[model samples]
Target: MPSPRPFSRYEFLIAWRYLRARRAEGGVSTMTWISLIGIALGVAALIATLAVRAGFRAEFVDTILGANAHASVYLSATSFTNELTGEVYTQSGRIEDYTDMAARLAAVPGVIRTAPVVKGQVMATAGDRANVAEVFGVTPQDFARIPRIVDPETSVGEIDAFPDGIAIGSGIARELGVVIGDRIRLISPQGAQTAFGTTPRVNAYPVTYIFSAGRYDIDRTRIYMPLPEAQSYFNREDVADEVEVYVEDPENIAALTLPLMEAGGDRALIWTWQDSSGSFLRALDIEDDVMFVILSVLVLIATMNITSGLIMLVKNKGRDIGILRTMGLTEGAVMRVFFLCGAFTGVIGTLAGVALGVVFALNVDHVMSAVNMISGGGAWDPSVRGIYELPARLRGIDIARAVGLSLTLSFLVTIFPARRAARMNPVEALRYE
Candidate 1:
């Protein structure tokens, strides 16, 4: 007779029979179930954690690049001579030819646009409520280009009339008890210079637009005004503090540093977004690595259940193995049978975990809402977390990694037990019976 093929039908049949045996008949059904559940839970946790990490990072970066400049060009300090006293003194940096500077910066390759901005801090008052706000003086056209402010889904009110009025963040509007068409007063410490000294400049502008940048601090404090109005209120006259540069690709902004410098001349001092947020990004990367290591250990601990379950199955089936070996089964056939049993449990558990993880990631927003409702609506604090809502984004590579880790562990732990069953002495196994 021809020798049976490797992992023949009989091996699978015997493996299934052993797996389906009743618990009362020395079966390891309970242990198998425990192992399966452990592996499933572990894999699910890994997938969910990775998805959330990815989503959080993406959301953070999006808000930064969408609402703010990818880079800024500031003029360096220059020596100025007093016309009356004839004394030379150093003056603070200010871009006098900002319009021309913006035009030149916009012409650089990979640059999308450049806007001259005058920034200042002022106290905003609407009725009895008052709060400190950071004001940005930008042209109506430049303000319209901001992704977050221009997105109709997240912003409300008319932006075409932005030059006629001012735009305020939703959080600021709420705190000051103001709405669209309401007027808010802005008080600047640096006002018109008089013979004696300077007086505070106070001006009121109607709110024409309300926007949410998806960041708590930004939404609570940022205000945008017409460029001319801002210059007048901030005492900047025809000068701008800096020129904000928007590029096609923010990630590779360093590559354009030389070109941008050449465009802005020797007095240009460029500051990229990375200079402000690189530390936070590095912290996030470190956290991701640590989290993966911790979750990997959890997965390993869960896979240990497989080892215990298989060892128990080997011991319980000693008598059966003796009979099968004596009847004509080879050692390799016995090993293959037990190996199939372990492999089946792992494959099924991993598949179930993947399904569970994907579903959870897809519906993370709904899950958070429900959780917040149950906890009386303070579960996620944007002020503390830097984001309004929790995010989850699933990647194919992350899922594949989780599944691979689980299945590899499951298969590896099954080997020793399967080998033990195969090497059992037929005479010794039947001696006890």
Candidate 2:
């Protein structure tokens, strides 16, 4: 007689035999196909959702970090500058290397570029329309370094065409009914005495460029101007609201923060995006947790189907389990056979789902656009929705998570069935009609 083969090799053969028998016994019936389809749909949904979430997170972060500085330096709260009315004085001991600071920051291992920013809140009015806006003064040269800050379609000459003029957000421009080259009035929050008691001090600044920051709050409220013009217009001599620093590695923020603060001396205070946008970051984390919990319901339901299918397989293959056991198969071998069947079911289901999901995620934009075209419209327009295209980003983290979760659930589904197969009584199983 030939030497007995290991169970691992025979497991596949046993699984195949059981599967063929299942096919013959109407195991792949409408109900079974429905279960498989359910699993596939669940997996596909999970993949697509995660991909879109990742894309949104990435796009928002990139846009924010690109336009805004990675880290910031501002005078302490009480030490805030009121340079417009000449009420604030610049200290001789202020950050000395304003330009050099940017160069040196760029030289740091992870640092990208450091740029100057001036901030103030003021009312922007044009004709009969008036709205409050936040002014962000930036150097044109430095602003160019931040991608997407300038519209790609707009030429460089068009951007700096008018010296001493400022860039306004698209929404703000719309609100004020102004376009590029239109003169807009800015009223500083600092009050001025008038017949109607004290009112905000106001000035007029011309708009040089129109921009869409892609963030509703920023786009609606933020404005940008040349650093020199801002400094002179605000009457701020040798003072800035903050210095924005960009870095290559966001994770090394804390490590660089200490050194940067030390280098900034006494007058400057450093804050990372994490600190500056703490609430937003926290909200993102909460959103992630909520999404995971909600999406995981699909996975859990699919796992239930896997469990049911395995249980049914065990019941139907009781005779096979007995025959295999009688033919000198170990209890572990018998168990492994059922385990393979269940695992294969899960693997096939998951793989199919992943493939479908990849296709869906990649083409979600086209699919959504087609659907939108067919349906006519929604309550909110695309611009109001924050993005025109449905975005999806496939990340290794998402893939690993999906694979790990699906495999773990699949293995779990087989546990009970495997145990039942292992404990099968040969005599009773064979006697069953």
Candidate 3:
């Protein structure tokens, strides 16, 4: 018949026309709105889940670092003798090169400070209350450098201020019903050995100052005193359990581990924050993977709506397809027109979901508060949940993954409907009209 006008640029316009007509149809019921909401909810949940997980990881790590050493150089097996003593005292272990090794580690880039700390586990008793605590012996001047240990507001003198002073955990202090300057008896496992066997001996080290660390385990378990005091009690000098090293950059921790070990040689085993917090970090990673996989199915289910919408559009546009084919439009072009229509729905739904998800993730704390208020519940305690506040870690990688998955599902939904439209018989389709 007459020559048909070119339809390349007209395909987008045609796709929109068909989509709008379908939207206007009487049968386009709850299914349509359900699809949109599903996609929106799925995307929002994914974003919020990841942000919370990241926040918990960061806070937990900070708590651990605050409580423990950033890194430590432990003496594998080393001990030394007192040269000034006329009588000889030999250690079963090798002599630890603390000064030389601490100096070498302190020189490393990102290394902020290094100090020698002596530690031992002893049972401290006051009346009926006896609790086991880690006795940390440190130099007063050097201990002041520790952030949590030295508070200018509370602490007046250096760590050495209390020659026989010990800082106990808050829980421990409460358990014994004692405060600063209370006398506590220290019972060490290393007691006097007689010809018969080991006899229990108790040394009473007056608790000069009791510092509360807040952690029940640590506060109750950790007792700090001067290094000299610990050395005299333990009956050993010129040696320690390990030297703690603090770094400015926690990210490049692995870089310092090997070098520190090399400087200290095989006699010392170097440990980093990662090593100390390995189990916790591993749990966080697994949590992210498990939640992503579980929530992604919601987005996939929502994509089915895109498929159904295109199928309805295909049936409605059969007459148009027949006319276009008769006008010399190829099957591939016919398929592309329908594909473009379905993709528009996918694009709009995905974009809306992303916008909403971002807003929700950002305002999660407020939303949570509102939820609590509505339910008449008290404020959430992060300590119970292992977090102090809601943390949202929104990364480019996560956003990319979400968008990519949504787009891919959208593209796939178009295939069956597009093929059906492409394969329509012109004569058969036109006969119904």
Candidate 2 lDDT by residue in tens digits, 238-315: 666667887878756888887676555555688887786668667867887788677677777786776677677778
The runs of at least 3 residues in candidate 1 whose Cα sits more than 4 Å from the true structure, single-residue gaps closed, are 1-5, 25-27, 79-86
Query: Residue 418, candidate 3: how far off, in angstroms?
Result: 2.1
Scanning candidate 3 in windows of ten residues, the lowest lDDT window is: 151-160
**Reference-based lDDT, residue 283, model 3:** 85
The TM-score of candidate 2 is 0.82
Measured against the true structure, the TM-scores of the candidates, in listed sequence, are 0.94, 0.82, 0.75
Clashes of 2: 0
Task: Output the better candidate (1/3) by lDDT.
Answer: 1
Candidate 3 per-residue lDDT, tens place, 1-433, comes to 6533434677788777766654456343344455567777777777777767776676667656666678988766545667787555544442356677778879877888888778777888998899887888787766666665555453333355566466666667778887767778888877677898776657776666555333345555788878887776665577776788888777678888888887776666888888867876998899889999888888899988877877777777788899999988888889889888877777777787888878877887898889789988656663355444566777767777888888788789889999999999999999968
How many clashes show up per model?
0, 0, 8
lDDT of 2: 0.72
User: Which stretches of model 2 miss by more than 4 angstroms?
Assistant: 1-3, 7-10, 20-24, 27-31, 77-110, 153-157, 162-164, 191-202, 327-330, 370-390
Instruction: Tell me the whole-model lDDT of each prediction, alpha carbons only.
Output: 0.91, 0.72, 0.74
Give per-residue lDDT, candidate 2, residue 84. Answer: 81
lDDT of 1 by residue, 1-433 (tens): 7779889999999998887758575448877887778888888889999999999999999999999999999988989899999999997788999989999999999999999999999999999999999999999999999997778898889878898999999899999999999999999999988997999989999999999999888899999999999988898999999999999999999999989989998888899999899899999999988998898888788778777878888888899999999999999999999998888888888888888888889999999999999999989999999889999999999999999998998888888899999999999999968
